[model samples]
Structures are given as C-alpha cells and as structure tokens.
Target: MIIFRPPKYDAIDHEKNLKESDGLKFATEIYKGQRSLSAIVEFVLSRIKNYVKKLHNFDQINKYIQGRTKTNKSKILLLTDKNKPTPLIKSIAIDYLSSFETAYITIKKNEKDEIFDFFKIDKDIAKLPQIIIIDTKDNPNEKEEIIVYDGDLNKVALSHYLSNFATPLEGPASKRMDLLNKHKNINNSQNNKKDKNKKKKNSKNTANAHDEL
Candidate 1:
C-alpha cells in the first residue's frame, strides 16, 4: 500500500525560504541504473515545480481554488496498492493543478501487507493529517465486493480519476460513463415493468367492482 503524509506546515517553515541556488538538484541529475529513494522523491518534487511553471495562469489558478479558497494551502495524500500503477498520483495532481501552487504530494509504500494487522496505525494516520486511502486489487484485508468506498460516493471512482487526468485518446471516464448510463437504463426498464404490473392489477379490480354494480 502507498500513503502520503504532510507535515503540519506552519508560517515558520514557509518563511525560511531557501534561495533558488540552494534548491533540490535531483531533477537536474539523470537517473543511473541504480538510484536511491531520496533521489526519486527529489525528482518528483522538481517535476511538480516544472509542471506548475508550464501551466501557470491566474484564471486557471482561480478556477482550481474556487471551492478550496478557505485553506491557503492543502495537502494531497495519494495512496495506491503495490499492485496498481505508480504514476496515477502524478497524473491526478497534474489534472487538478494544471498549474496551482497550494498542494503537495507525499508517497509511502507498505510492501509487507501488514496494514490489516495494524488497523490502528491506519486510523491514526488518517486522523493525524488530512489523507486519502486508495485500495486496489485483491488485498487480504478487503472483502470480495463489486464496490468500495473512499469517503465519497463513486460508481466509477477509478474512471473519475482517469477521466480528469487521462488524455482524450485514453478516454477512461468517457467509457465508464457509458457503462454507468447503460446500467441506469437497465434499472429503469425493470422499474417500468413493475409499474405496468401494478397498473394491470388496479384495472382488474375496477372491472370487478363495475360488474358487481
């Protein structure tokens, strides 16, 4: 499993701004065959900055933060199971930002599948700071079900994430939307059949009453 935890950022951390010269250099360094986790993390952070620079515009920023304006900053915790793709978090962030500067992403991986045994740790992490948990694939802790919950309703949660980020060619959301609509139509047809049966019963009762008269 993957988890992201953001520190309770205060004014002090923000104020001690490092000079541009002293910035993290992992982005500039090309990856060798073997690399460290810290190096990869640094690269991700740099990528975040570069991504924001490209799409930075006031109108876009305003649209991104319209509902989230109350908090000057927000933390994004992206968790994915080991089996799922790792790049989903970056794509989702890019979709939301397009180029906003108020969010950060941290990633953690739990390879041992121990989260089930230590349920309290999971709860504590959730409570400590704002976070999001994503469960993918067959984990021992999860039951076999057609649907799962992640704080909000989502008939096609994965599709929503991909739709908002994935390019038009990929069209993850569009395909999912079609499937959802199809499901609804089927449900409506069943409901209509039930309604017709009820009407037929009412008609039979009325005819019997008239015959008695």
Candidate 2:
C-alpha cells in the first residue's frame, strides 16, 4: 500500500519561493511591455476576452465546483450563535465577498441576517453575484465561508456565515488529537494490568503466610 507523506517544511518554503518568483515574472511581463494606461486597459480587455471565451466551455465553473467539494475548500469560520450579526461583522463579510469575482451566501431559515437582508446592498458589490440561503436545521448554528481562486483573482465565494463555525482539522491539530487519544488508551490499559498484577502478588503472599502459621 502506498502511504502519503506531507510536504516537509523545507519543501513548503521552496514552493513559496517558487510562487514569489513566478509572480515577479508576471509583474515584469506586464510592466516591461508599455507601462502606460492604454497598455493596462489592453491587458484588462484581454483578460475579459479570455474569460468570456472560457465561459462557453464552462470548464472553470465545473472545476471550481469540484474543488469546493470538501469543507476546507469551503473555508468556514465557526462562531457562537448570537442574537444578531453586528454591523462590523456584516461589513467584514461583505468586504471579503467583494474581493472575489462572484459570491454567494446561504442562511439558515431563522438566521438573523438572511440573504434578503443583503440583496439590496449586493448591487453595490462590483461582482454583483448571486446569494443562496439554504434552510437546513441539522446544520444548526454552524457558519461556513468558501473562497475560490487560482491566485489573487477570486473566481467564486460562498458563505453561510452563521453565528457558528465548523471544520475538520488536519496537520498539527489532527496529529495532536490523535496522540492524546492514543496516550489515554495506553494509560488505561497499563493501569488495568498493574491492578491485576498487584492482586496476584497479594494473593500469593496471603497463601504463604497462612501456610507458615
């Protein structure tokens, strides 16, 4: 059976460096070729053209949906159920969604700040995306946020920014929990064995003392 090994710290560092180098190359490519307003406009137009062309195939949309299948890709933020979402919280959530090209939100049936609450304001968002609110009670107070993007240009964003959050841990967090559980089981087993041995020893001593008497 093949086992998967996570990337080492050095490997992660190298990967980051490579990404930075690639970003610099892209910046250089744009800046080097006519660093004028017209050039910038032309670049933007080219990107739009590419985007429109890709929409016909719908590959990007499908890929984004598939990538978001997991909760991690969902990028949730769990929080305690509160009476209401503060103005500050609403602004922050909206701001995060604005950073993306498209954004959607699903609210529980009785959520304080349902999607209807934000529909009027969504027009102000440059993306002018759709928001969906699902009414599932089992999810209860769990809040979730999903952000999708290849890099800086966000493609899709979805959030169920409830008064709560939920996610399965990986990396160090998962490892620590596993170790704690293992230690607990081992300690319980050892204690049971020690108790058994102690009883056996005591029984042998009692028998020997009785024989001597």
Off by over 4 Å in 1: 1-173
Worst 10 residues of 1 by lDDT: 128-137
Off by over 4 Å in 2: 1-72, 77-173
lDDT per residue as tens, model 2, 101-188:
2222223345323332432323233231232222222343554333312122221122223212321122222345568879999999
lDDT of 1 by residue, 43-128 (tens): 55534322221112334322433323222323233323332223444444443332122222222344213432232234433431
Q: Scored by CA lDDT, what does every candidate get?
A: 0.38, 0.34
What local lDDT score does residue 200 receive in model 2, on the 0 to 100 scale?
A: 100
> What is the Cα-based lDDT of residue 70 in candidate 1?
26
Candidate 1, RMSD to the unseen true structure: 19.2
Q: State model 2's lDDT.
A: 0.34
lDDT of 2 at 14: 40
Judging by lDDT against the true structure, name the best candidate: 1
